[model samples]
Target: MQQIKIKQYGNAQEAFAFEEQEKPVPIDSQLLIQVEGFGLNYADVMARNGLYKDAPKIPFVPGYEVVGKVIQCGKGTPPDFIGERVVAFTRFGGYAEQAVGDFRAARIIGDRISGGEACALATQYCTAYYMTDYISNLHEGETALIHACAGGVGTALSQLCRRKGVTVIGLCGSEEKVAFLEAMGVDFIINYKKNNYKKLIENRLGKRKIDYIFNTVAGNSFKEDMKLLNYGGKIYCFGGAARSGKKDHILNDLAFLLKTGFVSPLFMMMKSHGVIGVNMLRIADNHTAVIGKCLGELHQLWLQGEIKPVVGATFQASQIGEAHQLLESGKSMGKIYVYW
Candidate 1:
């Protein structure tokens, strides 16, 4: 097997290496997949930074989701599974020429969707779908405020919300992303760089505050964005890209603790709002069956053309470093890919 493994804990430019290793063989009830393509995620970047909770030790392969064909089957494995195409979320060891996973964890990809598209949706869209439908409880015609509105989960939520007739107000980091969100049918876009997002929310939406807020970036913006939630609305906290950089201030630490603790949900109570925190990895860990169901629904939505995954770009296996660089630079809007 050829895999991209992290050799050190530091920046992407310094850590990852491409090397050859023995391919994995299936265990009891496990299926070995011949890699086609895999999606790059922020969790992969966090793992490289040594920030991801419970990340495997240094010198480990990091990839969450992949789409591939089953090449070999283990003893007692179902006979129908051989030669089937599937998508799955592996805790690690997915960025390689071959990997192994369980049958229940794998969702069969139907013939209507392409392999590349299925790979893109396997993790990103599944996360968004579960959060939007199960956690946020988003209703038709409800308004949604999406942070990181041009990234992988954001783009998926944009299309899904559009399909469900939910108006989306996209908040992104740049003007180019503003244009990108516009093309994706975003009802309004706020450039968090040059403008005031709080005022943009008030000015554009009037008194009907945001019905649901999907926040991937947390920090001062997380605190500020909470004010936009309407009565009985829910805010789903999924990621914390806002505090990505190291900080040293005494008050900053206190503030972050306060915000993550009581302040957020306290405000929710004051206004009859709801605050929900989601760690998809944790959800996948504890509620495996639920996560599998969500993946199945997302695949069906893709087959029906109700949602489309945004693939920023694809690279060959040797281009692993370049793929990580693109993710670190934040130049790409959606999931980056590495193919064998």
Candidate 2:
């Protein structure tokens, strides 16, 4: 088997090494997946640069979602799973041509959904569904602010909001992303690069405030998002993309804390605002059943055409480093897929 591993902590191109490894065998409740493809996530970029705390130690494979067929199954697994086309959430090791997945975290994907869409299930769409559908219960007529609104999970949120009749204000850093969100039927698009998104959104709605905020860009963006929230509004903070992906961002880290000051429980209670953080890896570790339910729901939506995954780019497994580069560049509009 061939796999790409994070060789050293640095830039994407310099961090990966492709090598041969013995094929893995499934154990109790696990399946051996013959990897057809996988999705490139921003966390993979952070992992390559040694920034993501959840990433495994160096010289480890870094991948979350994988799409493929089950070639073998373990003792506790059902015989029906073998040869089934499925999307599996391997917390890591999806970068390999073959990987192992606990059967509980693997779901049978319908023929209606493409491999790219299957990849979206484990991380991007599942996260969006878990937050909005299962947790937030985003209702009709609500307004949402989605930062990085053209990225993988951002696109999923846009699709989910549009289907639910929730007005979405999509925020991006590039004009290209703005155009993509516009086509996705976002109520508003703001290029945060040239415009003050917080001020622009304020100007448009006047006194009206956002009901939901899906934020990954933390720091100043986090502070600003709190003020934008309306009464009963909730902000789901999943990541900190605002820190420019530099090697030594210690100074930037300090600046991030300075800009985003500490807030006591009293302030949140007084304002009637809420902030929830999500680290999907943590969820997968502690709440496997929850992830299963989320993936099942997303699969049904994809089948019904209520939601879809956008494949911004696809790279062969050998080009793993380039795939990481594209995802981190912020140029890729949707999920990036890498196939064996």
Number of the top TM-score candidate: 2
Q: Give the TM-score of candidate 2.
A: 0.96
Which 10-residue span in candidate 1 carries the lowest summed lDDT? 241-250
lDDT of 1 by residue, 64-138 (tens): 777888889888778787888888777688898788876666788946666557777777787788877765556
Which candidate should be chosen as best, given lDDT against the real structure?
2
lDDT of each: 0.79, 0.86
Alpha-carbon runs more than 4 Å astray in model 2: 248-252
Q: lDDT per residue, candidate 2, 73-152, as tens digits?
A: 99889889989988998999999999998888889985667788789878999889888888878889889999999999
